[model samples]
Target: MTGERRRLRFRRFATRLERALDGGGAVRRRRRPGVCAALDRCGLSAYYVPAEYGGELTDYTELHQALRMVARRDPGVALAHGRTFHAVAPVWVSDDAVAAHRVGRLVVGGTRIASSLAVPGMGPEPHTGVSAYPVVGGYRVDGEEWVGDDLAPGSYVSLLSRTSPVATPRAHSLLLLRPDSLPGRGGPSGSRRLAFCDTRVGADALVGGEGRGAEIVLKARQLGWAAGSALPLGAAEHALRERLAGSRPPQTRRFAEAYADLLLCEALSLVAVRSVHLLPGELSVTSAVVGLLVPELTGAAALAEDAHLCREVLAAQFRSLVRGHRSPHDHRPQLDRLFGAAEAVVPFAPERIGLFSRHGSAVLGTLPLSVRRLRHLARAAPEFGVAAGHAERLLEVTDTLHQRLPGPAVTGDPGLGRGYALCFAGAVCAGLWLGGGPAVGDGPDGLWRDGLWLEACLTRVLAHLGVRPPSGADGALFDRLATVMIRQYEDGRPFSLLPFPMAEGEPR
Candidate 1:
């Protein structure tokens, strides 16, 4: 299908899903089933499966967009439904044909697979609660695992179990088992707990291999961190909308700062998601930056309501950032494609994703060039002067940050990590603005025009990094962004960089 046609179909599907969700009401208890059914009716499950495995998941960005759309309305529901995609990540990365096909068949048949892989912030280590001892036929499993919150009798659970007695990275193994095959009971927060009391399965249950679980799960979590960046973005977008509503609104500066933060989040997430395909090896740093910043920014807006989720997400990013290796690599072409919103991305290739980045973040490292390009544009158009100035400030702070950054083994400073993430976000905004090509006659409307949004975002990033702008300068940028935001709100559009039209009849 043509890109336009596919986008149209997705928009239609999004509209239908929104209508279904709107009919479900605000009660969380009643909303879960409705959300799942709505998503199923819209054929979202198919996107969770790989194209080679009889599904339409040709690109990670497509799945990210779908998840973001769902999350805009309900983050919890989005996370719940996103588990299916998360569950299949290890299967895809492992490249085990049998496991892939089996999981694919289940997913294609609309079965929700629950994964027990340690959450992102929980480190790449397998859950210590579960262990599988080698038995005659298959491993004898014994332990407790927290599966999906709303799993049913026939649902499948992907368990990460310790396979070796020794404490080693390769000691864990992944298994796909049915809930009915094991004894499970109710757990907290509506989750199902699998109590495997010497349960045995055939060798076919082992995913990837006996000692490859850690590698598979690590890669899968990286994918999760990159893709799940959308969740917080959507939630922040919702918060901005709420802030704009009602007779009395917050101060314009506050609302505008919130909007700028959301734009920054989107910029980072856009690059991170596309990196999964274009620059997978470098994704370690990029995804970690995204994972750290999204929640931090969104949590400040009170959008990331789930504190536990934020903690896990932050913890994961912290570990990845501290362990990531930094080597310079040429990724200019990839960066161009990543920033170009209309560009078609390459297919998802999980094999390219590495546990540690051999090359550091191309986005952050390329900041100087992006700023130089912005300055050059300013020289020609004059309208880009303000944005160029902000970009230069961002460059100064980034250079300072580089000097303070420790080597891969030593740095665990949260402040330095946050500084790096902010710089990365600033770089993305500059790259995206420049990627749009030289602005002609003051640029297009909304955020793009006059580089207004870019300047605001840069200013916000600088402030986060402790570089306060000149007096009155910050307020002016905030006022401009707030005006644009109010316009979007009045026009029934989402408060995003793209500002796509919200589903018709969507509830406030």
Candidate 2:
């Protein structure tokens, strides 16, 4: 990183985090909405827009830093900003039209609510956009998307449709419209379907073109993946600071590993960002999605527990602030649920990671853990061995890697903390898998080694959690990951050699 870049990062932090130091009593309590809006008005909302569109032209690093800063002070704001970023992503990836139609629309705030695939129980549809849809002119939109979240009530919405679905619609279309526009027909409609946890925000509108909605939405979700890393990364950082500030407690090992979780989050976050640009092959989207969701609580619980352990430490006010800031799942603002959203997205959430590590060994499903497979398994063969066999394979491969790999160095590595967290995070994934959550879904493609780092981290983290890899879960998880790595990296050939890494003194 350059000196200027470092300073710029600090400046960005200062700009977004001015709220942290404003008042007293856990800055989360008694927030000043006016301050938040003012900051957004000042340029916070346009952080990712290009210079031509009146944004800071913020790069990936700045966006990451800004998310951390905002999340650190108030995750609520961070989440809201995330939604906006998602709202605008279509423009960023909207081919040529991205600049003129979609990007230009958000630059001046012409739309209202933004809903991506996360919108209540939605699923992905195969690509279906025509280069020139509906042959008419301008933009015409139809169909209704479910709306929830606080933005629902009476907010306008920005939707993306497969351009080809409606001819005359331009490619990479971005549609901007109002909820009221659905006068029983035309120009995009709405329905009461999935409810988003983040519902505090007010109002909704539209952005860019209509008809060509899906492309914009897809681009946004893709770009939004990088930002997704920010959510848990910030939580992990705060957890570490909270634990370090406490008087040593019984949870020391878990605390330290949790501290490491933040580093892993950052490393993984960077990798995810690169994946956005580099476009890795054989990528598993849901696997990637769940990968980010799982480690969130590994760091979160460590922070919450340590804070409760030493509530007297006045310096650890962020803990209280964290408690005060409403999460995506907080049904009531006053009785806010801690790490609610983070918890829902993954199984074995909160202290479940530690609990499961102790007794419950997780086994993931092999028949693709998508909505379709889940439904099929649930309805057809409820007693299928989908989870157990997969679990055994993971454990087998993991042990092989441990035997083959060099002993991990324990000194002077900048990412040492990350190394530790990956072990636990991996273990946590295993636990989640046992609980019917799928982990390590990427089938032999695109930096599986990075995922291995996470699994390796889980091994160490499980020990810190006082978990003995109960029964056969540990061994099973190992085999699955090792087999995955070999099959993915070894050119899809059967492994004549054992699935192991190179030992320090072993001949190649």
Candidate 3:
């Protein structure tokens, strides 16, 4: 599907899915069959499969947008439906004709695939998740894989197991297994708590080649992290649409800041997704930027809402933020590794390789528009004196950060990675504002020109850098955002990159 077609199709699906789950009742309940049928009918399942395999996933941008749409309505359905692609990504990159063809057939046939990549004994240790012993025709597999209820009849799992005696992280290989084909020791196959015991597979089941598990896992994770940002983006929209419906001062401020934060994240995700296509080599750093900033943005939005609502708001946001993982901390180790890698890969002087510097024209093409943005923002600064010169100062910092980059030879410091990502986000946001780009979805006025939201965004970077905000900065910015947010909510629209129109008589 073309970009416009994907958006139109997914929007149609989201509308129907929302109505079905809402059931015209006060409480909205999600049923697997209803969700699957809706999605299947719309050919959403094809997004998971590659085009050559009869699916429509041409790039990460489409996947991100599609997942964001589902995530806005039902997180559980989004994750369950999307995780299969996470597992299949490694296979897709492997370029193994046979394996790709097989997976493609299953995906086109509407069969769900699960992953057993992260099993017990998976660390760099003597213990291995599953061992592949040499046999006549192929390697016999022996181990256990714990998984949730994602598996069922006709479903398969992509398993990573130890194939060589080295017993190291790099010594393993990947296998796409059929659970029913293996003899199960115990546990219900249909239950979410099922653990496959003594699972075995032949040589042809191997994903690409022997001892490629470590490399494959890393690539797959990068793809997953890049796509994962959609969940938070959608969740933020969900929370804003549901919780901020009043015209009161506090509610209005929270809504404005929330919307600004959403823009930063939305831009960050788009840049990262495009990088995968335009600069796959830099994905190591770009994906890390996405992984770290997404959680940061989600938490920030939740915090803003928490200040206005009760603990329930925070709890719901938390659940939406960390729904598919083992725990919130699950992303920490991966984050650390990615960050460490980023310091080496991220150019301090990004003009040579920066997305905004090189690719900004593709997204925002008018210099006149950019100048108007700066003027509008400049005009609004008088009202919130606390953020005076902050936007310009941030632009200056962006230049300095790029010039100061120590080059790719130095080992990356995780702390430096955080600062770099913030600097990158600030640069992109400021540049877009300067160009007077339109908001994700709004009227002729460039949304970023709102003095209040820009100040809030600049203040956030300053706070992160340990700079104290001017007196009344907090209160002034909050009140400013609150007004905008309230107006948007009253209009009955989602605070999204491209805002969705609400149905007639849709419940708030």
Best by TM-score: 1
Cα lDDT tens digits, model 1, 1-508, are 7878777776776776667666557524465767786787777888888878877777777778778877777777887888888788889899798888888888888887888735423353545678887999887887777765457756788888899998777778888887665533322224566677767777888999988887787677767778888888877776677767743765788777888888888877887888888888877667777767888887643423333433343334443333332334453345777777657778777778876664455666667788888889899999788888888988887766665564463244556666777888898888877774442223324577778878888888888888887788667778878888777767766666663434743333
User: How many clashing residue pairs are found in candidate 3?
Assistant: 10
Local accuracy of candidate 2 as per-residue lDDT tens digits, 15-69: 4345433433454554545445544555565566644556554345456556655
Q: Which stretches of candidate 2 lie over 4 Å from their true place?
A: 1-16, 19-26, 98-113, 116-144, 152-156, 162-174, 180-216, 239-250, 274-458, 461-508
- List candidate 1 stretches off by more than 4 Å: 24-30, 117-127, 183-191, 247-250, 300-334, 407-409, 437-445, 499-505
What's the TM-score of every candidate structure? 0.88, 0.48, 0.71
How badly does each model clash, as a count of residue pairs?
1, 58, 10
The better candidate by TM-score, 1 or 3, is 1
- Order of models, best TM-score first: 1, 3, 2
lDDT of 2 at 499: 19
Candidate 1 positional error at 106, Å: 1.5
Give candidate 3's whole-model lDDT. Answer: 0.56
Instruction: Report the lDDT tens digits of candidate 3 across residue range 222-241.
Output: 56667767877876766666
Among all windows of 10 consecutive residues in model 2, the one with the lowest summed lDDT is 347-356
Question: Candidates' lDDT values, in order?
Answer: 0.72, 0.38, 0.56
